[model samples]
Target: MNTSTHYPNAPVAQPVARHTLAVIVDNEPGVLARIAGLFSGRGYNIESLTVSETEHDKHISRITVVTSGTAHIIDQIKAHLDRLVPVHRVVDLTLQGEALERELALVKVVGKGEHRVEAMRLASAFGARTLDASLTSFVFELTGSTEEIERFIKLMTAVGLTEVSRTGIAAMSRGPDAM
Candidate 1:
């Protein structure tokens, strides 16, 4: 006689990691909704998402999604996404070495006198362009990494930031490979 115990149902916790995924899909109505639905339905959170038609003739679009999850969850997300009929390819840009990522922001600042001068000077140091300016307010256009944009916004807030509009991150892998 022998006595043995087994606990196969035990769960193991894994550290969460942030990933940037580039998905290529058919450019058609409802595609973006479907992708969003998949994430929502699965209870996954999207930190940032950007989509645009990349190849007009090919009728293909690219979606860049930033999400954080355990390794297992990330793998499952990719697998499920690849199984979607309209999905062409899913590339994990985060795991694919260094990639280029950028975001664009339109910042509007309202100030007078010294505040206005400081705002413009800081903007110049950050390489921000003056898109529109009036006696009391100025609208600047900035393009850079997310961190850079955030830092600029923070600095502007102290001066007189009034409004801001941002285009979510758009990223791609570096080198000769194409996605």
Candidate 2:
């Protein structure tokens, strides 16, 4: 170990920041796939994606996508999404204020005896529920912010985590007005 007292003030390599985009679009087949293709074709990566019908009659759907890029690239993505015929609007929720983000994940763990007991105890601490359970395996349902979910998963991995299925992030402004 070099004991030289030297401290360099070099800037760290900053990865592109993440932004959550909420897209309101006409609910139709192939729309989600199209949007995904647009990102993949352009060498962009989507960290999380969720789509659901917010209104009845299935006329409209909300697509929430979590992605990271430079400011200019993010702006370009917003513009391109807006140009899609089916997309009514694209809102960068991260740029907006006071947004509430939540996600649901099903984490499966397989273990025996103490491992199983420890898993349940840990899951309880995280407020996760057993959606499915057997002697050798358990499927836990957890809902929370991204960080919370990630932490829970990390803990589960050490306790015999088997797999996970996430519903992505659903976010909205927390105010009287709708986004």
Q: What is the C-alpha lDDT of each candidate?
A: 0.95, 0.92
Best by lDDT: 1
For each candidate, what TM-score against the reference? 0.92, 0.88
User: Residue 174 deviation, candidate 1, in Å?
Assistant: 1.1
- lDDT by residue (90-154, candidate 2, tens digit) is 99999987589999999999999999999999999999999999999999999999999999999
Candidate 1: count of backbone clashes, pairs at least 3 residues apart or interchain: 0
In the order shown, the candidates' Cα RMSDs to the true structure are: 3.8, 6.1
User: Model 2, which residues run further than 4 Å from truth?
Assistant: 1-15
RMSD of 1: 3.8
lDDT of 1: 0.95
lDDT of 2: 0.92
In candidate 2, which residue pairs clash? none
